[model samples]
Target: MSDAAVTADLETYLSERVRSTPPSGIRRFFEIAATMDDVISLGIGEPDFVTPQPAVQAGIDALNDGQTSYTANAGRADLRTAISEELSSRYGVSYDAEDEILSTVGVSEAMQLTMLSVLDPGDEILIPEPCFVSYAPTARFAEANVVHVPTSVENNFQVTAETLESYITPNTKALFLGYPNNPTGAVLRRDTLEDIAALVQEHDLLVISDEIYDRLVYGEAHERGHVCVPSIDGLRERTILLGGFSKGYAMTGWRIGYACAPAPILRGLYKVHQYMIMSAPTVSQIAAHTAITECQDEVETMRQAYDERRRVLVDGLNEAGLPTFEPEGAFYCFPDIRSTGLTSEEFVQQLLEEEHVACVPGDAFGPSGAGYVRCSYATGLDDVKEAVRRIQRFAAKHQNG
Candidate 1:
């Protein structure tokens, strides 16, 4: 094509779906951080700890043994079996390793497979707001309409049955749920999940439950244990469970995650996954297998560290005038930044520029997350402490600005 023709027609060549969707709001700050030096970032939900030694060793051992070829499309039998056993042991839920699980590049891919498999164009997914940034976008990419159900700090930032019911329509096909939620670190309790499960069954809705942070619940949540939505009585057949090694095992770069559902649902998900990705990286799958089966102590140790960081960061933010809520899961503290008299983006940008401290604005998650900022305590404790100090200084200068 001629340059003139290319220039004129390029705009039309793009898919409406791809063009209409907005780029990541989190990446806006990341681009700015890239151009700077000496910035302390609380922006990413990544663990600072190295992958546990045993998992790392397992990956190395697998590679050294030349186990590099692809395994079954569903994933290695041993790995799937390990995951199945872990689910049963942890959640009292049993999933057949043969047909109920599909492994993918990451929970990110697990989400994509589930959404694409289940949602028809124009179908709507009811998502709780103040969610992870990807939930709505991924649903939209699947050609599904996204209806955000408002969840607030007043309810510990969780979607209630009342709010969820208000958004339901005949077109509503699924509920996209993430808890031990991102940006807010709020884990749903049994009573709340039971209520939602009842609604799900009543509505005949499919559920995409992202439980990536299930192992990180703290204090009361840790004691009660995170509830698997699919494990709730009759909801299992209708739920797609999404999880990965990134949060729980600090294997973000390994890019391994999985999905579990009833055979009928999982069959569709697996077909999509088989065509899109033949298998997750074999070495990473081994690493994940080792992590799940042999690294319970390491997982607990890391969770403890995050818990300590959580308390310190939340207390420091409140003392710094950011007025943070106590987060019970995940590694973030979403503090109200409206007190600084700036929008979420402005507060984050200004803090980054003036204090060399970086955090994600709440608006990146959803409009309900506006007037707040998500600070990740996934960095070193000292860095978190210093970030608190820097943020306090910025807040003091700008509180009335």
Candidate 2:
């Protein structure tokens, strides 16, 4: 407990990377909100629904049958097979389960493994701005640089092939594609995917497609679901598709996810998975298997509820005089708060303190998010309405003054 001993321990114990990495912004908001009573949180990006009953039953059955031993590091063969079939059936992308897939603790681990597999120190990863909070930090942890490509409101926050091409450098090793994106619900069309695929091919860059929200589209039935980079010509062999049971199947706490990539990349990912995680949770894998095969109806039911909430939240925000872009997919609304003459962080803080409504500051996502705020509609209809009422009252007082 002496000063010198403490100093020596601090110096010796912490890795430089761990010392430098900032706490997650989303987590910080959650902590602050936890101290306040009567606060309605529309901030966290998680499904409010419980895991479907069938998936729960599957896990119970697995445990009752005494099937808790470690499965293969790449995951249970049956789960991987189901993932492969699900990909082909859902996205029109073919992946061989035996050689090209690896189950992960979650899409979070899959993302980190993918980056560590391909990125080296000083190599750059092209990420579209207003992305998930983890992308830049994870890239940094992999000793890679991040080059953010800014997407505009005019473009619905979708990254175009031209925008992507502008960021390519000799050191650029991969592109992080988050469609039905976090914080913003922008989605890519098939033609846009093809264009980006061609550009990535020409640049010889790998694509890491984060399609965790693929099944959460909120628009018309005729509209396309989330598009994967691998589905585009010339991109299949070079793209790593990341999926999970969290968002789509309301299985967030189960921590089940998978990655589909080319054989060689998957081999490297498996090695990483083996050492870092050993294997994903056994019971979660069982639940995930059931989710992939028999939970389509549950997915649709949740999607319909999210769709309705999305409309209610967006319409309410606009009515409150906040300029919000209509989200085509996903369960978030990114609204411009610059007109209120406050920074994104200030707006969010004041909203939490004065209105007792919690939302994430857009700037937490990236520079492109500086003037906006991300409101997630993943909660109940009643909470969404109350949050909007609070926001409207806040906006009126702020604007009038």
Highest lDDT: which candidate?
Answer: 1
Write down the TM-score of every candidate.
Answer: 0.97, 0.96
**Superposing all C-alpha atoms, what RMSD in Å does each candidate have to the true structure?**
1.5, 1.7
Candidate No. with top TM-score: 1
Q: Output the lDDT of residue 111, model 1.
A: 95
What is the per-residue lDDT of model 2 for residues 1-401, given as tens digits with 9 covering 90 to 100? 99999998886678777677888878787899999999999999899999999999999999999989998999999999999988898778999989999999999999999999989999999999899989988889899998999998998899999988888888999999998889898888888888888888888989999999989896752175667668888999989999999998999999989999999989999998899999999999999999889989999999999988888889999988889998887789999887788888989999999999999999898888888999999999999999999999999877633
Which tens-of-lDDT digit does each residue in 1-401 have in candidate 1?
Answer: 99999887988888888888888888788789879998999998899999999999999999999999998899999889999999999999899999998888999999999989999999999999888888888888889999999888899897898889999999999998898889898888788888998899899999899999989988888888888888888778888999999998999999999999999999999999889999999999999999999999999999999998888899988987888878889898899988889999899899999988888999899989999999999999899888888988888899866
Provide backbone clash counts, one per model: 0, 0
Reference-based lDDT, each prediction: 0.91, 0.90
- The Cα RMSD of model 1 versus the native structure comes to 1.5
Candidate 1's error at 121, in angstroms? 0.6
